[model samples]
Target chain A: MSPILTIIVILVGLYGLATSKNIIKSVFCVTIIESGLILLFLNLGNLEGGSIPILSGLVENIVDPIPQALMITTIVIGSTITALALMLCIKIFHHFGSIEWKEVLGREE
Target chain B: MNDFLAQIPIFLVFIPVVFSIIIYLFKAKWTTYLSFVSQVLLLIAFFAYLSFWRLHPGDHLLVFGGWSERIGISFFHDGLSLTFSFLAIFIFSVILMYLFKFRRKDHKFFFFFLFLEGIFLGMIQTNDLFNMFVFLELTTVLVTVLISYQKSGPSFQAGIYYLLLNTVGALFFLIGIVFLYNVFGTINIRVLQELIGTQGDRTVVKFAYVIMMSGISVKAALFPLFTWLPKAHGVAQSGISALLSGLVVKGALYVLIRMERFLFVEAGFHMNELFFWIGVVTAIVGVTFAISQKDMKQILAYHTVSQVGIMMMGISQIGLTPFYGGVLHIINHALFKSLLFLGAGILIKHYQTKKVYEIKGALKTFPIVAVMLIIAMLSISGAPLFNGFVSKSMIKYAVKGNFIKEALFFLINLGTVTSFIKFSSVLFGPKAILVKEKNPLQIISIIVLGLSCLGIGLFYQVIASSIFGITISTNLWEISHFLDYGLFLVIGFLFYRFVVKKDYLPFQKIRHFKLTFESANYMFVVYLLVVLGVVFL
Candidate 1:
């Protein structure tokens, strides 16, 4: 709900990132932290009881439109980033024949 | 007619994107002739375009879809953006020239490289935050592909890690954007800044600034989130490594600089302090590891981390300070670091060895390559009259008021010099056997770079004056900077020599956290849907 809460989530993400040995898990924790920040941001845009920003005569309380535009672009960007991450995951999995960082790094010939 | 030449800024961004599509469609099957022909033409055209900018003095150029400024999508061209973009184009062209030497098995490499080039070209000019995100994404996707082009396991893993965290970062940037838009009801950056300045006490704007900046900072590869950089840049092919290190990371910094003047002028939020420390930490940590590195590529990778830290140090000066020194360092770093990476590429290719200790006596194998590497090393080490000294001196000058920052900055430069000195010993020693010189393409590319390093040294004042829009009143051959540089170089060498121990500490593994809650794609979708629900309901 608060920006500080968002920062706390980021710290949690960093915690997971630093401690986890499984590559995919670390990535997902980072995702969680990122998502929390995103939620925190959306909450800040709340117009103190503003409704969805639409103009069908069904709602007079419309929120901002720019965030939605940005969100659309962000979503597009996020999907591609996910795809690239998965590709890397597969590469890591295949090459060192293990999913753990220690094993792959240890096996570097 | 002058307008056609003035179209330099736009066409520099345009030609690559248009030709990339053409190459994708028709030149897809035919790689050699078209790739060769197009890159040369691209280089020539790009140079002529930059020269045109030189002629137009202080004329801020803008092109906006043939519409008025507010309604149109604007490309803001100024001294800062133009020079950076020009550096990107120049180095990218060199990559293009050397690209054929490997004759990479996949045309996909060309496809991605060209696309990456196009993204870099467009990103440096756009003034819009939204447009910047789009180009940034383009860079992200293309770079991941390039890094994983070989489908090597280590590289692929590195790519995935990079993507995951960076996606997370970008998402935060987007959320910040949305919040700013929701508050201000506009997406134009200039307008957004003006509104923020007027609002004066919008806690939400400050929140947005912090959130968005952290996201970009992740891309910039600053500390606490820079873990992804060394591995990703390390595993990438030489050309890809060069581009990633030299260009893409700077994209995020560009946004940081643009936003800082207005959005991030807050107290106790000094990126300068954070960045100065980050620069020093990375420089020390990076070189410490560089000394232990057996893999030449990995060593180079660590050096990238060092340079990124230095770049960060330069940019951190933007906080409550009037130092444009950071901008100059960015230019200096881009040129010399790109040269260093390119030099590493030649070493890797020629000797068929990536281990530092294994590739002994490079001077015997390839004299020209050896000479270029030495020049690049000296340039990076802040050796007298080199480009590094000019900016390093400027940063020192800029920090005249901040003693703590100045001391840390000095130490970081010393660290840089120390690492390069270590790098030099391994470079030109002696040849195992005289390795055959490869094709002239990589050689010619290195020659061009070497010439630039030398030219910069010879004309430091001219470059200093040209970029800053101020002529130097002092003598060009002044001994002050050289003396400082020499003192640091000696100090750095002594410090590293005395401090580093020979006991090899085995490489430790970086722990990765699992995502039990949701997948990256799933989280991304949910976030977007929420925004959509909030927007169009």
Candidate 2:
């Protein structure tokens, strides 16, 4: 099922996050994990033969719209977090002159 | 009057936010005064609501747009939530006053700062899970920006680490929500609380509980997920550090208490033993690290972690007395810890150093500040006649007959006393530095906090009975309690003199130990797995 695939995607992202040396790579790994979660949420709300959530006409098996709306909010939040992280990355690189986590974060004050 | 009471929750959240935006857009000189005026008005409104609620005590739920509670967003005002909201607004007002002199012209700082207060208020009052998620994420973003406001290298690094780790944690929380929504078809906590007793599946509920708790653990700065706390709290501006340490972390804890009330406890999940042990470990780790730190801010930061552990231990106990003890400690810790951070900020600013060893004779140099700091220190160390002693004794009294728990409490108390003995070294010795005149606002804020610490300790019986509705049977001012406190002071002084003063090798190792970014993330995942294992087994 796609849920299992989504779990694997999340695991993959965690593994990458655990092993990534570059800060930007870590940021992307977090994005990957978030995307996986988004997929999982959408998949959980999906029905076997569901139509779009619009209820103008007779919509008996419309997929749950709550998860879709929640996911949209999550996507917006996740992207803003990503943008903030990247902005901090730019600042980190400027100050430490390197984007590698080991290089920038490892130094003592 | 009833209509006004209903609108108080919304106004608490929006007043600061609207003011912040107006301040930003107008950039006028008088806007600062307006903001101050609004804060005073909000305080008055909070008191009015509190008095009204006291007159007619019950849960007050306001559903937005007049929709039903199940579908619409709801703000629930109970004693617990209102107490925390009052604390948040109170502390924010103090911090605003503390920063008024220097930061009045800095509109950018006010924008994020006031906006953060609104989000924090919203977080505490909301009863919807998804709305909590949104507030938590917004809090994270606002805190990140505030942490790195200095634009320094360390600040930037700390800010990013906090953002990434907390965002990942929030994502896990979202995943938990997905599972819950799929099963229950509702995200309202009250509705779920009602439905969970009859219709919830055990395994999925347990899984979701573990995942969601892990996310909250990070926010609450539990044992494994606390690496960012010291860094961020230590590196930010002093007022921001006070706000973060005093109120921000407590917001997460309030959520934890709420979740346990509605879900775990209702579901018959007895996580007390597990959380109790976690609390012990967190306390031990925090105290050990705090003793080794030279920076005053870092010591106070780690102490927040340790105090949080004590609160956790109190909260995790089965009885009502212990539970309320923990709740009282949350308020008590907010008061004293903010006082400590704000006082340390003054010392650091005047001395031009964060190193506690380098700065000497605070009592001689800044007499008023030093005196207030000592009051805070005494309160934190559980000295007799201080607020900390009252709550700590309440928790201690709850575990009276259990030998292991009793000893653990003693050991934690001893460690707290020991580290504070080491911290108090700055108060004595000879005056070596000449500092400038004191800021009246700063002094007033700390003095108010310090006096409250004493006043609460002295009047704990009335406060506990009237506000919390709990009558204490254990005599707080008994001779035995004083004797026990004296023993801790003596033993702690000896330990600090012999071991910590000599810079013991183990302490040195703890001082230098730092978790890298990747490893901290790895530890968070490992923490999640450990919680999953424990909950399942």
Candidate 3:
């Protein structure tokens, strides 16, 4: 919920993305970074003590709905890319018989 | 008629989408014909809209869903967006004409091609930042599909690398957008530009700019983030390679220009120096790699990197003249580079090989294509009386009286000439064994592009004025300009014969030096950190 926590999540994602050898882990790391970004956007729009965006008679402090709408689009885009990436990894695996980043290029002529 | 013409931007974007769906669902063999008809219609719409813009000379906004500006998507047209979209349509139509008769029959090719056209049309038209991001993602996915359409060879690997890196880059872009939105509540570009101007320079805003620029640099294939480009452009289908090198990367550069010239114009000078150095480094490294490459496609691929650097260098200068030069070069580079790539494709297909050494005597076997190749080669190398000369000279004239910068620019030109000499070697030597008959449509495509090169050069003033709405004197008739080009050519020829020809040890080492995907990913992190430091420190 805190902005600092989201930054840490992003840093962790970057670390995994940088160090990981497996192609699948790279995709996972991308998803993690996307999640962190979505979380940050959601946090930015939060009212300290707010009700749902849906208008009710009791609605007093409502959260900004723009970022939430933006995150939904971001989530869809991120997931599509992730899905395509994993599919490509499978194709790479089929070609190289290994999905480790170094192994694929090493085994190729 | 006037009222109907007002919605031309909508027609340009949606027609392709509708046609692509039609092509896909029908599975008809005449899908290419369908695509070509739709593109022609779009081109007509563009011409009508462009004439309207010329008469009005202002932004024409098209609001979607009838919502307010702060909440809804909008498409606006001015000169720049119109020119870019026109370029996309022009190039795509040319490609469609060539591919219709020459390429192998595949239904999906038409689908992807049309889809990409529509996406590019939308990319230039949209004014919303989030909408730009969405189109960018769609383009990334579509380009990846087109690149890996062959589904084998190095392209598969190239596709994966391109996909992964670009996805990461897009995420960084999204992060930048998030920061921007938190600071300023709307995602509209014009609104952001006004806010940035009013608020002065904030550290968070500067940081956001750096983050976004880094992300875009990856897409533009600038310096450190360009590892995936050569692989994808060199190994993919020739049409795909030509499209990627020629127009797709320019999308990112367009965003870069908009941001620098509009959003962050106040602090632009601080960032300009950084851009200048990066452009110089990218240019030098690109040409160095190009000089060592034995494969024709790889050589062209590397040259794209160098040429992009040159464009960046042009824009980094503070003057409007140099910036105009940079914009013109984007158009020139797309025309000549795609012409070269497509011409090379014909040769590669005929010979059934990509190695330059394996093929010989192009001038003898394919006289027309070889002539086209020569025109393209000269234009790219900035020979006098070519399209490249006009823009390159403008850039040079912009940085006049600065000796070190002038010399650096000269060195880049020298490198360009030297590498192109090596590339053009296949045109000479004895006649090679002919493999098969060449396609008539391929020759037509080459000639059309070749004529455009000459036409641009001959009508440089008129073309520049019309497209960019700027006028300047071009003294190509002067003797000194001739001598400069002549001297550069002589030096370049000698360099190629003596140094590049010998397979020198350093060249060999650099040629064999591979940047793996993991290391390239590491470089992205380093690039981001360095950019952050440069912006905030």
Candidate 4:
């Protein structure tokens, strides 16, 4: 059920990405999709009644730690990509004087 | 010595990275010299290790922290990975020499460039799926930085488009990994391969394969996803363009080959027929677009797409000969295509124009560049006694009996010949104003590549047998082969004279055709859906 929900969220992001006119919006949409993916991965690693991954007294049904570890790395990587994309966006705006995809990319060299 | 040989993979990946950081921190005047020395030393070490490994013949896997292979991140040194790593280092060294001769003083560019090499080497050698994902993402970032290094508007545009599109594609790959990890509880490819062979839901595996391949198709620039390649490769500096076109895309193809071998083929899935048809379409579409382009780099960029299609065709064949033929073509294409791009770079710089029609009399103004370009052209167009002829004939020999496939091959080759005929016009016209050749380093790099093309063509049998251990049965020197090539040249000349030279309405329309970012994403989605439908239904 959670997987389906996260997938729907991902699709929403995809839809926004396909229709977004502004470059910033596209970047946000990608972030949305990435957030959804992270959620989906975490949910996949969850147990029915899992406790926090920290090993307390009983250690019953500790959620799988690998997905959490992987997602942390993914988050770092994804943020770096987001920062890079936005930086490129700034550069694009500085050069073309508009951040609209049509206005920026459509100009003839 | 044996231990050192085993650790070559680690060194191959980290050496560039370590050098890049040191160069970045130091920012000394001798950074270029230092980088050059490092590359040369790395090449020497690689050759020494290669010889030693060949003599000793032992497993070269490096599991980190002394952990079991299934649990730890690992690097596998096999024939395929080692070959590609060698290519990465070799091409990076050539570009280094080219830059050193050009006297580029930017420490930042060197930093990113060397870092990119490290990431690329890591991508090629990694055996873990998650590890590969990390390397791939890092590569995309590095390539984006390199593409936008010029800081021009078009460069930024191309960089952003490439970054966003490829990130989305990488996300798809990640999702595929999520599904696999969910099912198998492991992300190690070797472990997954074994487990998948024994048991797994067939539908899930099929879906995973489709998703993973869709992501790879973007990287490989197959069919609809190739829109970014020309924009990116066309806008960059010549060395970057050559590296991007020559080796970077091949990394994706290498991954595809690995995935197909370990996962799809291992688990009772055979999509060779599907890939063959896709290859045919990619070839036809790529050629149609290439033939209409007037810009020299754009024309060469589109040909990379078409040649990749041809490579896919050879790889998708069932026979072993065609498979290695495709592999060999990858190396051959790298040689000639880099030579062509580097040559085009020189011409573009000296002639001060990118349009083929506007730039004339290269033969007179720059004799060396012209000669090198001719060799590259011959190699690309499958002229006899050139490298392109050898692999192309191998692919042709595989499809010899089937009339329709044969016709498709013939059509693709004809397209290549015709477009090159159009390209060759720049070599001949009235001699333009004489421009003195200033940089001998540029000449040296291109000459090295050009002679390599010739040498590879001349000694293909020895190289093929020694490197790949595959004996070629196709008689390369057959009279019929030369006759066929001559026939192609003649017909291609006629076609170019009558149709392409005139620049018909259809050609103009094709030249003007452009895909917006939104539409490109839509096409990616449509491509994914289509592949999914084809695979499942």
Candidate 5:
């Protein structure tokens, strides 16, 4: 599909994030959004008949390896972010003894 | 000399990376020694950059891989890049020196700080766009954990928010990079510059500029995208706040500058107007929020928004294209801002309270800290002979090309002065004994920065023209100095009365901060998808 579709995915994901009360659910939505973007990037570099970007000595055309390389970096970075976010989630739960964003966000402080 | 300087610059970037990995095996004491050794080496590298600037003026160096430019990784160091890298490494070295005290019980913070410094240095020096992305991600991962280093509710929530915000911004950045790589066939900055120079302006080029700047503006925390900045900054530890506010946002600004010059040429100049206007709005609204803040660091956090406005305004105004003004202020802000935050860290460590009322009488308790803080206050407020004035005035005159822009920015300056005036009062007026100073290292750092601020103002022209490689005209110096001294006197009085004693709301620790893994995972995927689609389309 078009890039607009991916943007729509982001908007929906954000909508879920703003409205969702569970920290874990919000985190999951963020990852889903990230996955969609990665898929889009992979699609961007796609050739009509291309398989994965691994070494194939065939004469047929292959996808660009740069974006693929970048994707791995992005994925690793994304996972690290996910891990850190979860760690923070655990910390928040420990301090407040609750996962509901509304109850915590309600205070003016 | 030229050959050595150029080769050493590349080695500087690699040495730290190598050392960082090597130290991972036995990090407790080794990391501390490794960071110290690397930081000293980094400082020497900065000095080499200085010599190269003196030796070769207004020239950009592209360190290509042994292969041709397009296919190889290149290190692009320009007048702009060199200046930023120097400032970053200088501050980083100082931070590393102070890390000794912090290393007493924790290797985690120490290791992370060095890695953070190394990543920023690598990001600044690398001309390859893909390499930039790698360093950027490295920075993000390190900083996310830094935000949550202490692991409290507020820290955790802030960490989560920062991750969400930065990830989205980074994805936008990747999208921009993908678009550029598609259109130009190379992501190396020097190569891209040549390509854009040949074609000049096109729909694709303009589209790329907008997309890329959108991503950068997010990281710079400019205007609408700045919502996460204060929360993340306030929630972080004092040192982390300093680094984030003083340097990390600067990474984004540096990239935007490089992109503007290389990709859009003057096509991106229009963003200056937007940047200038939004800067004023951000300054006014941000400081308005600051005046309401009672939480000490949160107030400083909001002040970051205001300071960012001033720095951007320096660059956006006409006849200020070299943007020396913003660069200078960036250095000034990093010095004083970091100093203030570190001092605040000392207080919190002692008193265990961040509230304004609760943090009273710091002057009596920590006399040395009080003195250091006053110096920072003077520097931040653009007082005479301090660094803040030198660059701020350059911006003030630079933005005065028209009546409306002039008026808006003047009001911004007034608001900035007023907000700082308020902070200075709380800093010295409080007589309460909080934390006794345990770390002499932190205080020494504050003093070092304070001196640097004064030195920057005294040698403004030399810094702008000589070290920074900007060709400074006598007229710009004359006008800027006059304005600098003018704003100083007026604002100095404003600080002493009608502003300092005014009561304001302090933002305490955010309560019951929320975290839902499901939502976070979902948001992450969607944003990453946006990056992908942009590349594909």
Candidate 6:
């Protein structure tokens, strides 16, 4: 059920990416896609009533730490790419004085 | 030497990252010298390793962080990786040498330059699926940075579009990786291959295959997903354009090929036929668009799309010779295409214009560069006694006895020849005013590339056998072959004169068609779903 919801979130993100008029919204859409993917990945590693993944002591069960670690890297990459893209978006706005995709394309060189 | 051979894979990646940091920390003046020295060392390492591998002929796997191969990250170096690394390192050195003179005092440029090289090296070396994803993402970011470093109007737009599309595509890749891990409990490619080999087909595996392949197809610039390529390659500086078209885009395709080896066990698969038809369509569409373009850079950019199609067609076939031909074409295309882009860069700078019609008398004004461009153009168009002809004929030989495939190949060649004819017309008119003197470094770099093209054409068999362990029949002197080539040229010339010269209705329609980012994304999603449907249903 939660996995289906994550896919729904991804679908919504894709829709936003396709239809968003504003560039910033599209960047946000990209982040949303990343978030949904990360959620899906984390969901795969989850165990019901699992304890924290640590080396303290042997427990009955624990969440898989691999996906968690991988998600951390994925989150870092997503945030850094988003930040850089938004910086470029600001530069684009300054250059063309518009943030809408259609208007930005319409502006002549 | 044996111990050192084992360590080459690590040094291949490590030297570049270390030197990138070193160059970044030092003064701007030291950046060039440091980069130069590092590239030379990298080149020496690559050649020594390649020569050792040639003698040894075995796979070398380096386990990262001192872990076992079953669970730890591992970098696999084989003939395939070595071939691409050789191409990448050689092109990097040549471009760095050329840019040495034209480089401004920007330390960030050098930093990204070496960093990009390291990422590419690591990408080619790694056998871990998740590690490949990480490298792919890093490359996406670095390329975005390099493309937008100028911060111009078009560059910024191109950069953002590139970021959005690639990020979306890569996220899909991650999704595939997650699915694979969930099903198989491992992310290493070799282990997954062994598991799938024994376990046979499953619903989740096929789903993961289609999703990951769709994502990789975006990077490979396969037919519908190639919208961002032209904007990014055509907008940037020539050096970046050369790198993007020559190496960066091919990196994705390389990963696709690597994955195909492991995931899709041979026979009864749909992707083969799908890739073939896509290649045929991409060839026709790419050239049709190239002919409609008025800008020089845009023409070259579209032509890159077309050549990729040709390479795709070659590799898509089932036979060993065709596969060798395709691999060989990758290297051959890299050489001549980068040479053409760099040469076009020089012309654009000298004329202060990118318009094809405005540029005049390159042959008369810049005779040396003109000759060099002619060599590249000839090689690209597969003219006799050039590098293009050899690999093209190998591909032709590969698809022999299939009249439809042969005819399609001929049509692609004709399109290629006709477009380059239009491109080469700049060589024959009144001289442009106030041409700049040629830079010696640029000249040397181009000359080296040009000579390699000629040398490869002359000694193709030797190079082919040495690199790919296959010997091609170099029967260029046969009268029948000459007649066929002559027919191709005559028809190509006539087609250009009557059809493309007049700019007919269909051609005009192609010119007016533009795929916006929204439609492009939509196309990607549509294709992804379609491929999934085909694979699963």
Tell me how candidate 6 scores on lDDT. 0.85
Instruction: Identify the superior model by DockQ, candidate 4 or candidate 6.
Output: 4
The DockQ for candidate 3, computed on C-alphas, is: 0.70
> How much lDDT does candidate 4 score?
0.87
- Give one digit per residue, the lDDT tens place, for model 1 in B47-130: 776677677765445656686554356776667786777787778887777677675444556666776777887888886777
Give the Cα-based TM-score of candidate 1 against the true structure.
0.82
After superposition, candidate 6 runs with Cα above 4 Å error? A55-57, B1-4, B51-59, B266-270
DockQ of each: 0.30, 0.83, 0.70, 0.77, 0.38, 0.72
* Model 4, runs deviating above 4 Å: A51-60, B55-58
lDDT per residue for candidate 4 within B369-421, as digits (tens), equals 89999999999999889999988877776678899999998999999999999
Q: How far is B434's C-alpha from truth in model 5 (Å)?
A: 6.4
Q: Find the 10 residues in a row with the least total lDDT in model 3 chain B.
A: B261-270
Candidate 1's displacement at residue B486, Å, is 4.8
**What are the per-residue Cα lDDT tens digits for candidate 2 across B162-257?**
998888888888788888887899999989898877786789888889889888888999998899999999999898999999999999899889
Sort by TM-score, top down from the best: 2, 4, 3, 6, 5, 1
Error of 2 at B24 (Å): 1.1
Task: Quote model 1's TM-score for chain B.
Answer: 0.85
Candidate 5, residue B209: the lDDT equals 64
Q: Estimate, for each residue in A34-53, the C-alpha lDDT of model 1 and write its tens digit.
A: 56655665555557778888
Q: What is the C-alpha local distance difference test score of each model?
A: 0.66, 0.88, 0.85, 0.87, 0.70, 0.85
Clashing residue pairs in candidate 1 (N, C-alpha, C atoms within 3 angstroms): A20-B512, A25-B513, A25-B514, A25-B515, A26-B513, A26-B514, A67-B178, A88-B156, B361-B430, B361-B431
Model 5 lDDT per residue over A18-38, tens place: 566677777776676677667
Give the Cα error of residue B492 in candidate 3, in Å. Answer: 1.4
